[model samples]
Target: MKTNPVIETLLSHRSIRKFKDQPLTEEQIQLLVESAQAASTSSFTQSYSIIGVDDPEIKKQLRIISANNQFYVEHNGFFFVFVADQYRNQLIGRDHHEDTSVLDTTQRLIVALGDASFAAQNMAVAAESIGLGICYIGSILNDINKTSELLQLPDHVYPLFGMAVGYPDQDPEKKPRLPHDVVYHRNHYNPQPSRDALDAYDQAVRRYYETRTGGTREETWTGQIARGLGNPYRKALKPFLEKQHLGLR
Candidate 1:
């Protein structure tokens, strides 16, 4: 059956947690970064940067900071740590003799985060198109202080997220998502869809997990969300971000 190019590419995408022990070619890495830069930027400001972790020692250190995710340390042929960077612009402002203290504000930090996320997703799609696998490690937020020091991040540059890329060694079952109505709203905002949509999605997820992972069935989506949200591992992020000089009050 024929499919829309975008839809077909997206349907083929999945998080790959396992990868073969092989490094990517220079040509492949160049194409990945180039495609990442092609993503849209807010107001054409492009307030972001990506640090490619090439050294094994550095990648090992980052793995510890990211809660010891062995997959992050060993699997990927390329590890790109996307950064929310305003220092580059601050330098530009300074060259023009303009004050850049505003770069420390929370609002500007949001802009950098938005830019970094967009670029990261673009690179992910581009890699997937070439039969590469991608996984995002939000766990990098676990130790912001250590990450800041390891990467030698400047005042206005913060690690937003990390991406692991390589050929897939395993094809994990695709996790189910809520129906479109739950996330996509019409002209006017509506919360009703979120209310019951999650319950139905929970069943879809449980069936997937039971057949794929052979894991115990999930009770409900609400319960799963509550379990994750209530964990202390998720709560430590605010203080961590503050320590890195991000989200300045």
Candidate 2:
């Protein structure tokens, strides 16, 4: 397959859960943020904020909030929480005596989420390009209220996700992804995916887990999805958003 430097960097992506004891230089952090800022935003809203966590106590609290298993949250060279933010925009609107009710709409919330996700991906790619490793921590939502209070996030600002970046202490193998035919379609959507392709990909994922875990754990992609969706997780997410004065519509 043809590959360029950017493509190679993307294909080599792995979630680094372990990191060396070194911390990132201020210059590196600035570059990462600049890369994230360069990401496209909806209607130029730029509805996002990046919070860098450097306080040890705060990191410890966040580690606990993240289930206390992901030590990388506290041990990484740098940690960032990408926030879906419209609070700043709302403040601007208030100062201009304009109605800010639109900021609370679901459409605005989705826009902010998309903006944050795009920025996070840009930062992830930039980190990889600079020979650094990164991992996204979605468990930050496990205790949404606590996370919000911990970060002192205001209304119209939600902690979308957290990322840990650092020099890698381990190099794990890349997990297999869904086959192209299963995900890609022509001009129209494909209601029926290729079962054969899905089965092959499941087997590949099972093999990956087995190899990575020394044959002790073998799970397929479908199985993982089933387990994840079998029970409702973060049932308070909607209420939390409502409390934050977002996603009302």
| Clashes per candidate (backbone, < 3 Å) | 0, 0
Cα misplacement distance, residue 44 of candidate 2 (Å): 0.5
- Candidate 1 C-alpha lDDT tens digits along 1-249: 888877788987788888888788989989999999999888888999999988888888878877674655545788989999988998999999998777777988888899999999999999999888998987777777777788899877888888999988887888787789888988998957765677788888778878775776545666778897767664565775576566776
Q: Tell me the tens digit of each residue's lDDT in model 2 across 131-248.
A: 9999999999999999999999988899999999999999999978899998899999999999899899999999999999999998899899999898898988999999988999
Worst lDDT run of 10 residues, candidate 1, spans: 66-75
Clashing pairs in 1: none
Q: How many residue pairs of model 2 clash at the backbone?
A: 0
TM-score of each: 0.90, 0.98
